[model samples]
Target: MKAIVKSARGKGAELQRVPVPDCGPQEVLIQVKATSICGTDVHIYEWDEWSQSRVNPPYIFGHEFSGIVVEKGNLVQNVEIGDHVSAETHIVCGHCPQCMTGNAHICQNTEIIGVDRDGCFAEYVVLPSENLWKNDPSLPWDEASVQEPMGNAVHTVLAGDVVGKTVAIIGCGPIGLMAAAVAKAAGASRVFAFDLNDYRLELARKMGATDIINSLNADPLHIVKQETGGAGVDVVCEMSGHPAAMNQGFKMVTNGGRISILSLPVRPVEIDVTNDIVFKGITVQGITGRRMFQTWQQTAGLLQSGQVDVKQMITHHFPLEEFDKGFQLMLEGNCGKVILHP
Candidate 1:
């Protein structure tokens, strides 16, 4: 079998021939059909600080994928051969306190597929049967491969009720664009999207943003304020993770409004906690991965109902041999979801 391997430590990945892995008793073997490149994949490919700290070399490294069940271990019961599926990339310890409390997404001991172990950038990959999400046969493989990230967008936008309320998303990356669409589908009266890239801002508009603002020259807070009659947005989804964008989101959120942040800043960011949070009586929440099972269910519903269109989000497709081109497009930040056929 051929797989994209993180062959060295410093930078980039290589497609190399490797022996096919055998499924564990509790795991199932998936015949990889389509997989998508994530921002995390780019970080690993570039050997960024996060990847430096977390990923070790000689590992297969992709998590977002749509595949077919080619084989299953003896203990795997519900999932069987021939099931079309994608998976929850975060594998958690079922015994953790968070898991017991129905917050398994934050389990103390969580192993991410692509980061912690061998991943799906191969002809075949193995995953715990429990993590497999059966996809609707009608869903395109490219779109199905991205459900994991789409779940991130869903969890962020639906953290609070946005129906009939104004909402502002602080980035127009793939996840941010999806959040804008989710906000609109969930009935946000006005969805304002902010990003420095005009290409992505235009994509956000197509994703259902009521307005788009390029934060490079214009003030997002000012535009949002003027559009909302100075009250600010009732909800803000912070997806940029940049210090300035974080501050902008804090400023654009109305007093007593909700702010759900899914982005991770590269370094420490200073904030006026007293003025930006305490005095404003704001309710701020930190978002991680999708809620286990629950968010997945909602994601499936949204896709099946056609409330959110992710097909428009996919900009490029490549075979496993052309992974470099996909990575280059992602590095340039000119593309949305990029899928790979193994």
Candidate 2:
């Protein structure tokens, strides 16, 4: 098996021959057909402070993937061989308080597949049976590889009811674009998307955003207020993770509106809670990962029904041997979610 392996910090990943892994008693062996490069993978490659603290060296890097089950362990009775599948990257302990209460997405004891352990950037990968999800045969492997991130979009938008409400997304990245489509499909009256990059904002427009805001020039708050008749938007999805964008998102929400945050900010920044959140009576919710099987079911249904245009989010594809090129594309911000074939 050939895998792109990160042997040390601040080093380029190399394609090396490695032994294939066998399945555990409760796991299944999947032959990876397609995988996508995520922002976290770029962070790991750059050996940033966050990745230095979170990721140990010599780990296979990738989490968003779709493949076929080649073999199943004896204890894995739900899934079978030859089934098309994707997986929940977060492996949770079912005994935790959050898991017992049916909120496994935020389980206290969680190990992410690529970050904490080996991931799906290789010819074959092993996953716990509980994390594997069966995919509809009508979908292609390239499209299925996006389910993990698409699930993030679904969880963010579905955190609150968006039907007949005006919604705004503060970022036009891959996940943000997905959120735009999901919000429109879920019956949002108007979808506004904001970003610094004009290219991404264009993509957001194609994804069903009724209005696009280039924050570099126009004032997003004023534009959103004017678009909504000064009432502001009913829902604000903050996906930029930038301090300024986060602050603006809080201010863009209407009174009693809901704000769902899906971005992971790197540093602690001060916010004007008095005017932005407290005085406005806004409902703020922090979103992390997916909602376990619930998010998967909703995302799968949307994809199967062709309600969400996920294929538009995939702008580049590369072979496994060209992993470095794919990472460079992401670092340069030249494309959308880049897919890799192993």
Best prediction by TM-score:
1
lDDT of 2 by residue, 1-342 (tens): 988887798756878899999889899999999999887787888887788889988988889999999998999998999999999999999999999999999999999999999998999999999999999877899999999999999999999999999999998888999999999999999999999988888889989999998999999988987888999999999898899999889888999999999987777867888998899999999999999899999999999898997888799999999999999887776677899999
Clashing pairs in 2: none
Candidate 1 least-lDDT 10 residues:
264-273
Once superposed on the true structure, which residue ranges of model 2 sit more than 4 Å away at CA?
none
Backbone clash total, candidate 1:
0
Q: TM-scores across all candidates?
A: 0.98, 0.98
RMSD of 1: 0.9
Best by lDDT: 1
